[model samples]
Target: MVHGYSGKILWVNLSNGEVKKQSLDMELAYNFLGGEGIASNILFKEVGPETDPLGPENILIFMTGAFVGTNIPCGIKTTVVSKSPLTGIYGESIFSAPLGLDLKYSGYDGLVVKGRAENPAYIWIHNDQVEVKSAKHLWGMDTFETVDAVREELHDKSISVVAIGPAGERLVKIASIISDDSRAAGRCGLGAVMGSKNLKAIACKGTGKIAVSNPERLDELRREALNIALPNTKTLREHGTAAGLIVFEQNGNLPIRNWTRGSFPEAENITGSTMTQKILVGPNPCKTCPIACGRRVRVPSGPYAMEGSGPEYETMAALGSLCYNSNLESIAKANDICNRLGIDTISTGQTIAFAMECYEKGILQDTGGVDLTWGNPDAIVKMCELIGMKQGLGAILGEGVRRASQLIGKGSEKYAIHVKGLEFPEHNPRKFKSMAVAYATSNVGANHNRGSPMLVERNLLSPELPWKEPVDGFLTKDKGRMAKVYQDLCCAVDSLGMCKFMVFWGKLPLKILTEYYGAVTGRALTFEEFMRIGERIWNIQRAFNNRMGITRKDDTLPERFLKESVNEGPAKGQIVELDVMLEEYYRERGLDEDGKPNEGKLRELGLGWVADIIHKK
Candidate 1:
């Protein structure tokens, strides 16, 4: 018996309105583990090179980790995988929400939605039953309204719903899938894929409890996790992710004015400490999470007035520093618009910043008489609404910075900060050299969450990394080794359905994770064996991209990061030595000159099939 999983996969074909259930292969489960690992494996096998990201041929997969629906701490993350409309490659986003747990309880290990619906529709899952319901009325609703309306119609307020808003409805490439109104699977434009499939939402409810192999041991691990997480995450709990803004700004880690500036003087105005002093209501915790890094905030009697999830560090950096808008309330308001409209805040803000730069350079004309000048909070908010609704100039911007720049090409691509067609997140690779490697090699493109070695580069994570010496944040030396280890570790944690924040607070040990897996699945997994699973998953994702024509040349930073140096702040005069990092990274990753994973590495990781695919390419 498989102790951790439901041992069933729910496959929904939107084209024919058919629902099928298949038992999960135990051997596959053992190899891929769960969450992103399982999703990546499925995508690699099903989605091919010719598959259009937004076409009916593409498939969207949602998989929970083995620990999901169990008592494991911070095990509420769900992996959403597909060929991204934004990146045009293998794309995966991990989000924390109760939806994953509910899906697990619905007697399925994962949900795979394939093909396109004939009309607007939604998938409803109640244990042992599935329904493809017409979503005609819910078609035009925002994310918040969609969730409310779905819950109201179902007469189950507790039902977990993952829905896209108007941005998704309009097929915005930066669209996001919002779970429970606030939590977002925000990267790679998976929501656009949902939109292409005519899927409005997926609502799930389940009463069944997951069975564990060793309940007592699982309980013990949960207790220990709490103990480790509680004390270590006080700052996070109190300040949320915004706490790092001032520090990041000081260190030149913040991307200001669309990656042109390394620091923002107005950063303190939007810092977490300021947010707490101004509009903070409380901390919002995810299901089974102890850190409670999510912020609940209310802006009193302003245009941005209302209660909702506050901006985290990424949102703050993207909307605040990246655009040079330090108005905290305005940033929150923009965040609210993104949340409700079902758009990725990072991408939305980065696109707006890109447009602003274009406007400054006379490449893009003012749209509808709204001047998109830098530091204009009103213009930023207006653009958010426009992009969300896909109205006016927003229509062009909705396609994402990559396509938008191409449409308005007059050296516009030079100012467009992106990797693999996906816009850059708020982190600047110039500040953290290891991030250069991470941004370049990420399957989803320019995403910080894929493998953030910033912590290791700063010597933050402890019991020490496997490197010979402490890593320096500014240097490229041994960065490839540092990034490789961190990426593998991050992949393992995400597959296990554990939140990355837990790594900071809990300093979570490999032994603890292995023990938890054994306790839940009744399968003894060694640390070495588990780490190998992460490596295998990473290789599989790379293989998926390789099949789509991603080569060593594609594994590169934007020209801005490679050629431009920071003109101000602590990281002033710093330019990412991407060529230096890429060579070392390719070598350490066992990739050939063209960045294709070699046969030896694939065979070593039990991925000879992947090797075969790459070799043919």
Candidate 2:
């Protein structure tokens, strides 16, 4: 068992308070390849199609890649899989570093939690042993406090704990699973699934070592990754992802005022460059990640006198320009509150921004009848806490923009700005047709990670865009192909435990991937075959959603984006012709009449093995 992993799959039956461990399945390992692929395959087979997302019958799976807990670079990644409380579909959230590695070293490939606990409880995993302990005291704590309390109970500073806060306890649809200070499995309401389980935290410690078949090749790959990390790391180090804000604004891609506009008034001051110059203290890198995109910021002796995580590009757009808040300190404060309380920043900011617009239009009044004017930093700060704590109006806001808008409908649905229940990220689809296609068909709602071709299409380096000589951020055509390529490429990265940023310079081709895979598994396969597995995994997940009743009709952008024109900036008068782009996209993806995958295409991808399972119902 050279490249063979020693970790077992841990299962806990909460209803009976029974815990067991099973040897990891080598066949599943070679087929699914772990992370999203393995998680999706297991969830599809084990969880019934009609199981209620919040019910005890639904499973909560925390999985890691096979490479996790090893010396391999960026292999320390984990995935949380469950039926989403928000979308009510096969769902997952990916996180990196310490938590996954700890679980693996603790002798578990993954942990599957089923049935609700009789009372509040937390699972303690030490080496190969597992126990469900009472967590009545941990229930009321925020994420930061939860970690502190759990560490104290375990009496081991070295143990890694992934826990939820009051938001998860309250079953907020956008609640997060926070781990290792700032790392989070932050999307798709997986935290709410943990809350429904009546499980407070999972703490683990390990004394085992992970092995690789070829140490020399592993060391060689490590050297290559580190060499790439050195000079190339400056992009993330210098500006972080926030570095893209100015580039986004310059290209009219920033989502201003709930995407009613695409440009902001004070984009410069809120850009990443400004944050670095103002309050950035240092770079924060994840475990084994060469590109440290995370930034630590401290605004001592100011209106915001705290030190914590700064606003990444998404936070800056959603909280700053989207809400019209020019104060960077307020944005940083919001990020910290969301992290501490374990909430998704993008959804929180979007909900509040939607509320701000509602207030401006007289749709909502403060319970005390206070006016919520745009750019009111105090009101913004107050609402952030209010949302985190789920207090009064904050409770309604915690349901996310989709539900909140419906609860206070006065034509406000038009401003909710979400696709398939999840709020849109900072990118504006109206400005990039590829993003429009990506947003419409994303398995997890309007997420940018599924296929972020914004940089490619915009040609950030060249003044000219990709399609034509004259750059037009708002134009639409041939973007369907762009979306298709990036989606497959991104899925490959997700499967391999590689950061998507590696593709920024150029794609980390299948040759590079297969070389590494061969080093690990000793399997001789072409890059094409490795990619076929990735494509197969993607289709399997898509088929999972389709099995849950997602149809071609569900693939659509919000009406606001399709109907409303970008009323300001270089992208003025631009509206996403989503239907045209989506139609082209459907064809490009090899889907038929109603956008179901064609048997021919499925066979072409060597996915005909599952065609019967997909088309039977």
Winning candidate number (TM-score)? 1
Candidate 2, residues 1-617, lDDT tens digits: the string is: 73636547888988888888878787666666767777777787777677988889989988877567667666767888888887777677777747777777777778899999989999888886789999998888888788888898778887888998888888888888988677778788888889899988888888887776777887787677566545655767787878878777877888777777666768888888889999899887778766778889988876667787677788888888888888888888878888888788888888888898998888887534434677777777777777778887888888888889899988888778787888889888877777988888888788897777665666532112133342354667777766776676566657656666643542233355556766776666475566566666777777778778778998899888787887667778877888887878888887766656777777876667557777766
Flag regions of model 1 displaced more than 4 Å: 467-470
The local lDDT score (0 to 100) that residue 247 gets in candidate 2 is: 77
Candidate 2's clash total is 0
- What does candidate 1's lDDT look like per residue over 1-617, in tens digits? 67999899999999998899989888888898898998998999899988998999999999988989888888889999999989889898889968888888988989999999999999999998899999999999999999999999999999999999999988999999999969999999999999999999999998888899999988998788778768878899999988989999998888899888866878899999999999999998887877889999999876778689999999998999898899999999999999999999988888999999999999998588878889898899999999989998898888888999999899999888899988888777888999999989987898888888877766567453575345778899888876787788778889988898886556665578889999999999988888789888888899888888899889888889888997889899999898888778888899887778889999999999888878874
Can you give the lDDT of residue 462 in candidate 2? 18
Error of 2 at 373 (Å): 2.0
- Residue 447 lDDT in model 1? 89
Computed on alpha carbons, the lDDT of every model, listed in order, comes to 0.88, 0.77
The lDDT leader among the candidates is 1
TM per candidate comes to 0.98, 0.93
Cα displacement (angstroms), candidate 1, residue 590, comes to 0.8
